[model samples]
Target: MSFTTRPEITGTFGVATSTHWIASAVGMRILEQGGNAFDAAAAMGFVLHVVEPHLNGPLGDMPLLMRKAGDAAPTVICGQGPAPAGATIAHYKAEGLTLVPGSGLLASVVPGAFGAWMLLLRDHGSLPLRAILEPAIHYARHGHPVLPRVAHTIAGLAEFFETEWPTSFATWLPGGKAPAPGSLFANPDLADTWERVLAEAEVAPDRAGQMEAARLAFYEGFIADAIDTYLRDACVMDAAGGRRKGVMTGQDLADWQATYEDPLSVDYHGWTVWKCGAWTQGPTLLQSLRTLSGIDLGAMDLNGAEFVHTVTEAMKLSFADREAYYGDPLHADLPVSTLLSAEYAEARRKLIGATASRAQRPGHIAGLERWAEAAVARAGRDLAAGPGVGAGEPTMAHLTERRGDTVHIDVIDRWGNSVSATPSGGWLQSSPVVPGLGMPLNSRAQMFWLEEGFPTSLAPGRRPRTTLSPSMAEGPDGRQLAFGTPGGDQQDQWQLILFLRLVHGRMNLQQGIDAPLFHTAHFQSSFYPRATKPGHLMAEPAFGEDVLRDLRDRGHEVEVAEPWTVGRLTAAQRDADGLLRAAATPRLMQAYAAGR
Candidate 1:
């Protein structure tokens, strides 16, 4: 057997994995306390907001995939907030903006993560509201060791925050300086906020009512009041290099709530893989799988040039479709059925050849050619811009100045309940702190186009096609799997690669996660400036020079990443025999899996 960075955690009781050890521990603690996977996942989600503040926050968005013990398939919990009523292409253009500023009040969306978690707890969780939030409040008030990357991200934006976003400066830099790496850092304001929410929730006198009370406290109560007051007159510097006020209001918060939706699924080689819906970039993975189903992936070496090239090419095609057609289904006529159809996949698969193609190619469906054309036109436009002062999602260190990304949580309890959630957007750099709330607004609005007639066009009350995707699957042997990663555009890409290895290459959970990872940035990014790198493929150095050379020979613009730096993935699964398994990437030495 090949060596893995760590053993795949195995247990008969429960397992949890996350981007941070503290969050994973919190989840395990919940499980140990007799809470189910939903309860544990809710606790982990809140704790992650505290510990990985630079990566995610209360105001961020999340796409969760959850399966109850007896359920045949996982369901989706969409924590993604929509564009505010005042958010529109006309208003943005009037502000002299072509694209929504990647950072700043102008890019604010209705905060959804908090509401989503509350919804998850209310519907599926058995724990009390206070039990789920206590850990996060503790970390925020008492303090947790600040991650080095968090410090570096704060330092990079220190000057900008101090000068342009003094509110952010005051919050992130308490003593007028970025906290030193590993230093105990606390956000008393955030702690106080949660404490107040809890106090209000407790008035309901029961778990279910308390959960609803907490939701109201955040959406229609103090949380919304604070955000509304902050954005009212605060014209702050944004990623577009301009000062702008926001359009979000308390009413927007009052109008929005996290909802549940059916997951989109596709069967591949006896496994039924599930993803959050077309509203996110989740369908891209399904599309990739459909395309790959026609190919014999098992015939190629998992880490060799042939495997890398084939997967990369398939991803480019899938992501190309993402740019063209994937958007909030509530607002657009998405051709999801056709996009995931077997015939369409076969047709698209024919386009993949021995050489890399640099073109942006979204498949043409009858009558949907306009969307595809719009995608090509938007991608072709030369919008020469760089990531504004804290404007992009946390991705690879080399990919953005703000090296923070998103966070993923995977949990499975003894009862067979499971959750895979990817939460992101309200990074420390996304926007200024909302004064009293101790968290910034999400910049998800930047994912919407300012142009009209496209599914992703900026519109009030529409969910931005988010890159925050979580995944679940059921194997032929009846093992239920919950898996996901943190990279924005690369979330599904990295997940697709790992799933393939686990299914075809016969690697254990840890082996698949620890294996050298790779992804292509050959499609328009979902973040600010929306840059596209044609034929670009980034792989970890562990893939070896020979494989890299082979990729280059196939016309891939291969860039070798630092050893163990490609993906931040975590996974958990419940086998048919009642055993639980979990694993996390050792790429950044941050992610951890906890199980007996």
Candidate 2:
């Protein structure tokens, strides 16, 4: 047997895996208490908001893939909120901005995480609203051990929080200081906010009524009022180095609600992989899978330079398409059908060569040449800049900047029900805390382009093409798999590698997650100061010197990362025989997988 950081948890009952140990435990507890995977995933998501506040929050965005027992295909639960009615390119231009700031008020979107969780729990989940929220409330009201990275992030931003965003300072820095690492830290205000929602929800008689009441309480009632009141006059420093007020309003919240949609899928090697729609970068993974289907990845050494180069090159092509064409399907006419077609993949696959390509090359769809041209032009621009207070996402913390990231959860109950969710945005550093609400609003609007005529252009009521992607698939033998990770742009990249290893190399869950991972920054970033490094690749040093040298020789701008620092992936799967299995990456020693 190959060495793994941890054993693949096996059972017939249930399994829960998450970026944080506490959240995983919370999910497992839900499963133990007779909740299905949807219920368990919802509970874990709320707990993640409390425990990994720096990574995700109650006001963030989540895109989840769920498969109910006996369902042949997974469905998408789009928790991604849209740009507010007032968030238009004209308004942003009037504010003297070229790109949407990565952090602060101007980048705020309608908080969607809470709505999404509620939607999941209300429709598919079997638990009461209170039961799903109790774990998070307990952690938030009492306290939980602060992660070292969270402490470090707070310490780095202490001065900024105190001077520029006092509300945030009051919420994150209690007693006039950042909490020490491993110290118990609590967000009583957050607890209060949820408790109030629960109180309002319980006023309704039954489970269905309670869920509806909770949704109203959050979107049309107190939560919306609080956010609207806060953003009304709160202009603050943003990534563009200016003080700006947001365009979001209570009406935006009231008008928006999480919705369910069909997931996009591509068949590869008899395995049908599912992902969220083009609204997210989810289809990039699907596109990459299609592009690589023509290659013999199973014949290559999984950890060798050839494998890394081919995958990275394929991802570059796919992400290039993401920048050009992927956007809110509700607002734009996306060429999704053509993009996922086999002929398109065959045409794109021919672009990969022995050497790296230093160009952003989106495919030539007849009527979409302008969008492709805009993407290439945008990529060539030198928008690289230093990180501002709320500049980047957490997964990119490895960068010189102290950034925040997203969190992921995978749950599979004994009945074969499963969910894969990636929850992110609304980092503590993203904006000031809404006065009484402990959580900050999301900065997801940073993903939109200030330019006009593009698929991802800034417009009111449009969903920003988010990088938050969760994945699901059915193997040849009818086994179901649910998996995802937390890196912003690297989310799909790492997942692709893990899935390929599982499909081709036949590695077990733990072994696949434990394997060395790499990702390329060849495409434009989805954050503030959207920078692009044409041939850049970051890989874990565990790939060894020979492989690294070979990659460098192939013209990859290889940057060796610290051992096991590349990805924080977690996965769970159920076999045809009814056996359940799960695994999590040991990269940060924070992710965990729990099962019977």
Candidate 3:
């Protein structure tokens, strides 16, 4: 066995893992109180919104993959909100943006996460909405220890908020200064927001009625009213280096609701991996697995140069396809069947050469090549001069930026139910906070394209092709797992590596998560500015000199990153013997796992 920073948590009763220790503990607390996995996850989800405000918030997007006890298949709860009716390509262009700004009002989307959590609590969870929200309410009203990174992020943005967004200034700089790290930071407004929702919910006689009432409170009542009223009059500086008013209206908020959908899956080796459909970047991992299925990865050294090269090359090809084909399937004719076929993988696999390729080589789908070619051309020209500045999604950074990505949670209950969710979008830096709500609307609209030709083009009521991807899989040996990470485009790349290590290398959860990680930046970023770096591959320095040298020899633009800074992944698993296992990456020192 290899040295791991922590033991793989094993329990027969329940397990919950999340990017924040407080959220993980909340979930376990719920489970200890006999709440099922869905109930525990809902509780933990709310806690994450309060405790990890820099990483995620109530206004962000979340896609959940869940399985009921004894069910063979997992279903997706799509919390990703759609573009508002006023969010058209023409309006953005009229606002002088060729791309959506990374921050401010114009980039805001209908807040979906609040309603989504309510949905989970309503349909799948057993606890009352009040019970599910208690931990978050307490944390928000009283206080929680502020993460140092959160403090740093706030400090960096203090000037921006004070100068351009006074509402944000009041919320973040309570005393005209950023909250000190380790200080008890409270958002009494956020707590009041939840309390109001709970108050509205209590008027209902039962759990189902209460859940619906809470949803209404967020989407139709005071929350929506405050967001709409605030946005209508407010215009602030955006990524285009200009100030702009938002296009979303109260009608948009009232019109949107979280929906459940069938999950997309692909069989690899002996296990079946599942992800949210094309609407999210989840399918990118599935496509990478398909491409890798044709390769004999077992024969390669798990941490050696060849393995890294092959995996990175495969991901490049898959993400290239992602740029070309994947989108909101509701709006686009995504040839998912052809894309996932073995023959197509074989054809795409040939593009993986001995050296790294600089081109964004999207495959030629016979009937869809015109669309594919157009997307490829646009991708090539779409490269941002550099990363988007200011508040944006939980983004991947080397050591330069203090910006973090998203938050992830995986929960498995004693009853055998499981859920994996990636929640992101609303960050303190992303947009100005709604005055009364103490949370900013998500900037997920930045994921949409301003140009009119692609499936991801900004359209009324269409979901942005989100990068918030969660994962679930069933191993051949009857081990079921839920895992995900928080790098914008790197979510799947990190997940694929961990899964391969778990299934093929026979590594336990911690071992797999702790393994050195790497990802390519050859494709356009999903966030605003949409930067791309041809042949770029970032690896943890712990991967050592030989692996780095081999990758460099293969023509990769290799950059060594600080150790334990690449992937923030967390996972929970249940084995055939009914034993539960959980692990979280030690990379960020923020993630934690708790169980028996």
TM-score of each: 0.99, 0.99, 0.98
Report model 2's TM-score to 2 decimal places: 0.99
Number of the top lDDT candidate: 2
lDDT of the candidates, in the order given:
0.90, 0.91, 0.86
**Cα deviation of 241, candidate 3, in Å:** 1.2
Q: Write out the backbone clash pairs for model 3.
A: 394-405
Candidates, ranked, lDDT: 2, 1, 3
Model 1 lDDT tens row, 1-596:
87888999999999999999999999999999889999999999999998898788999989888899999998899899999999989999999999887888988899888888888899889989888999999999999999988888888889888999898899899999999999999999999999999999999978989999999999999998998888888998888888889999999999998999999999999999999889999999999999999899999899999988999889999999999998999988889999999999999999999999899999988998988988988887776564457567745637554644799999999989899999887889888999888988888898999999888999999999999999999999998899999898999999999999999998999999999988888888887788888888888888888999999999999888888788899999889999899999998898999997
Cα lDDT tens digits, model 3, 303-338, are 889999999999988888888788898888888988
Return the TM-score for candidate 1, rounded to 2 decimals: 0.99
lDDT of 2 by residue, 1-596 (tens): 97888899999999999999999999999999999999999999999998888888888899989889999898888899999999989999999888888888888888888888888888888889899999999999999999998898899989999989999999999988999999999999999999999999999988888889999998999989999998889998887788888889999999999999999999999999999999999999999999999999999999999999999999999999999999999989999999999999999999999998888999999989999999999999988553456556634427533567989999999999999999998888888899998989889999999998988999999999999999999999988999999988999999999999999999999999999999998899998788888899999888999999999999999988877788889999999999999999898889999998
Superposed Cα deviation of residue 44, candidate 1 (Å): 0.8
Give the least accurate 10-residue stretch of model 2, judged by summed lDDT: 393-402
Question: Cα deviation in Å at residue 187, candidate 3?
Answer: 0.6
